[model samples]
Target: MTTYIPSLTIPSVVLQHSAASVLLPIALGTAVGFGTRPSKTQKTYLALKQPPLRPPPWVFGPVWTVLYGVMGYASHRIATIGLRSSASPAIVETAQNSLTLYTVQLGLNLAWMPLFFVAKRPSEASIDIVTLIGMNAYLAYLWSSIDEVAAWCQVPYLGWLGFATYLCVGAGYLNGWDLHDKEVKEE
Candidate 1:
C-alpha cells in the first residue's frame, strides 16, 4: 500500500493528539450533515421509494455520529500505538499510509449525502458507497498489522458500511436509479 498522498492524507501534526484525532471525524461529519441541509435531505429521503428493511431517517444521525467517533479513535490508535510499538521504518510508513486511506474514506463518507440527497443522483451515490466500502475494508486490513485495537475498532464501521451499501443500491434500484424525480422542495 502507498504510504502517503499529499492530497488525501491529513498532516500528522493535526491528528497527533488523541482528543483531536477522536473529535476530528465527529466534527467533520457533523458539519457535513448540517451543511448539506438536513431538513432538505430528510424530505428527499422520505420522498423516495425506499427499499425493504430501511431504517427510519432519524436512525442515521446517531448511528453515523457513533461510527465517526469510533473510526476517529481507531485512526488515533493506529497513529500513536502503531507508531510507538515499532521503530521500523516500514511500520511507521504503514501507519502513515493507513492514516492517508482513512482521510480518503472520510471524504467518501461525507460525499454520500450530497450525492444522494442534494444532487439527487442515486446511481452515483450507490457507486460512491460501494467504493467507500472497498477502501475501508482494505484500510482495516492494513490497520491489523499495525494495531490490533485499531483494526478491531473498524469492524463496526465495516459492518455498517456493508449495510449502508445495500441500502444505497437497493434505494437506487427501487427508484429506477433516479433520485432527481424524487426531490422534495421545502416551503
Candidate 2:
C-alpha cells in the first residue's frame, strides 16, 4: 500500500528554531480555543450528556497546553537533528515528511474546537478527531526512525486523542449527535 505524504505549509527554516516550533501550536491552540468563545462553548459543554470518565472543562486547558508544548519541542528536535547537514538524504526526506505530517495534524487539531464548539457539530468533530489520531500515529512511527525522542513526544498527544475520541463519540451518541438543541443560551 502506498502512503500519501503532505507538503509542509510552514517553512522548514521556521520550524528549526525551538521557540517558534514549540510556540506555534500553543499559540494557535490558544487563539482557536479563545476565539471560539469559551463562555458559549462551556455552556454548550455543560448542557451535553457526557460519557463516563469525561474530564472537567477546566482540565482541558492545562492538558492541551502541555501537550502542545511537548509536541512543538518534538518537532523542533526532528527538524534540528534529522535535517542536519550530516544526515543521510533518506533521513532528511523522512524528517521533512514527518514535519509535513505534523503541520497537517496540528491544523486538524486546531479545527476540532470550532467544529465541536462553534459549529456544534459533534459528528463532524468526531470524524476530525479520528482522522487526527490516525495521522499522528503514523507521524510518530515516521519520527521514530529519525529521532526517537521526537517520536516519543507524540505519546501524550496520541493518548489524549484516544480519550478524546471516546468523549466525542460518547457526547454525540448521548446528545443524539446534535449539540445545537442543547439548552445553551444564545450569546
Candidate 3:
C-alpha cells in the first residue's frame, strides 16, 4: 500500500490571520533591532571594514521591511493550514515545531543588531548570525514538506542571512576583538 500526502490549499481565512499572526512579530523585531541603533552604534558600524559584497547601510532597513512582511504572510499560511488540520496529530506537531523554529529564528534576528551594533561585539553577532542561518535552513526544509510556497518565501531571507554572515565574519576578523573581554569602551 502507498500513502499519499495532500498539498495544502490556501483558504480565505488566511487573509484574516496574516496581519495579527505575522506582521506583529516582524514589526516588533524590526523596531527593536533598528530602534536600538544609537549614534554610537552607527559610528561603530561605519568604522567597520565591510565585506566585499556588503550593501550600503541604507539598504538593510528597506530590505528587512519587505522581507519581514513576506515572512509574516508565509508564516501565517503555515499557521492557517495547521489550524484547519487540527484533527491530525502529526500535522499539528509539525506545525508546532515549524512555528517554534520561526519564533526562535526571529528572536535571534532581534538579538543580532543589539549584540553587533549596540554592544559593538561582532564576535557574538557572528555566532548569532551563524545560528540564524542554520535555523532558517531548518525552517525552510521543514516548511517545504508542508507548504512549498511557504518554503520558497524564505529564499530572500536566507540569502540576506548569508550576506549578513559574511559581513559579521569579516568585521570580527578585521577588528580582532576579544570575545572574553567584558569591558566596552565608550567612543
Candidate 4:
C-alpha cells in the first residue's frame, strides 16, 4: 500500500520578503475599496458638495493605485532591513513596531470606505480619516529611522491623506452630517 504524504509548501523569498509585508495590504485595501464602491456610493459621492480642491472622482483610483504600489515598495525595503543578518535587537523591535503601526494605519484606511460609502456616515468618515493622517505621519517618522528613502516615499501618501481629510470634513459640513445622529436627513 502506498501512503500519500502532503508536502508543505514554503513561501518563496519574494513572497516572504515583500509580498506579505507589502502587497498583501495593498491588495486587501484595493479589494475592500472596490467591493464597497457600489452605485449607491457613486451616486452619493456625485451628489455631494465637494471641497474647492477636490480631485475628480476618476483621479482617485489611479492615484491610489500608484500610491499603493509605492507604499508596498517602501514597506518591502523596510522589511528587508529587518531581515538583515547584522540587525540589532533594537532595530528589529523598531521594525516590528513600525510594521505593526503600518498595519493599523492600513486598517484605518480600509475603515473609511465602509464608513463613508456603505454606512453613508460622512462625519464618522471624517473622524476616521483624521486619525489615519495622524497615524500615517507617525508611521513615516518610524520608517525614517529604518530607511530614509522609504520614509520619503510615504510623503505622497501623507499628502493624499491630508487632502482626503479635507474632503471628509467638507463633505460632513456641506451635507450637514451630524456625528451624533447617523440617521439625520441630509440637508
Best by lDDT: 2
The alpha-carbon lDDT assigned to residue 163 of candidate 2 equals 97
What are the lDDT figures for the candidates, one per model?
0.85, 0.90, 0.74, 0.73
Record all residue pairs in model 2 with backbone atoms less than 3 Å apart, i.e. clashing: none
- Candidate 4 residue-wise lDDT, 1-187, digit = tens: 2122111111224423665656666687779877885555566677777778877777877788788877777777777785466888877777767766666676778888889878878878988988888887888898888889889989999999888888889878977874333332455
lDDT of 2 by residue, 78-121 (tens): 99998999999999989888888788899899999999988889
What's each prediction's TM-score?
0.92, 0.94, 0.81, 0.82
What overall lDDT, based on C-alpha atoms, would model 4 receive against the true structure? 0.73
lDDT of 1 at 53: 88
Q: Of the pair 2 and 3, which is ahead by lDDT?
A: 2
* Residue pairs with backbone overlap in model 3: none
RMSD of each: 2.2, 2.6, 7.1, 8.1
TM-score preference between candidates 1 and 4, better one? 1
Model 4 clash pairs?
A: none
Rank by lDDT, highest first.
2, 1, 3, 4
Model 4 spans with C-alpha error above 4 angstroms: 1-16, 19-22, 178-187
Residue 5 of model 4, lDDT score? 13
Model 3, position 180, has a per-residue lDDT of: 30
Query: Highest TM-score, which number?
Result: 2
User: lDDT of model 3 at residue 125?
Assistant: 88
lDDT by residue for model 1 over 40-115, one digit each (tens)?
7888788888778889999999999999999988888877765675547888878877888899899999999888
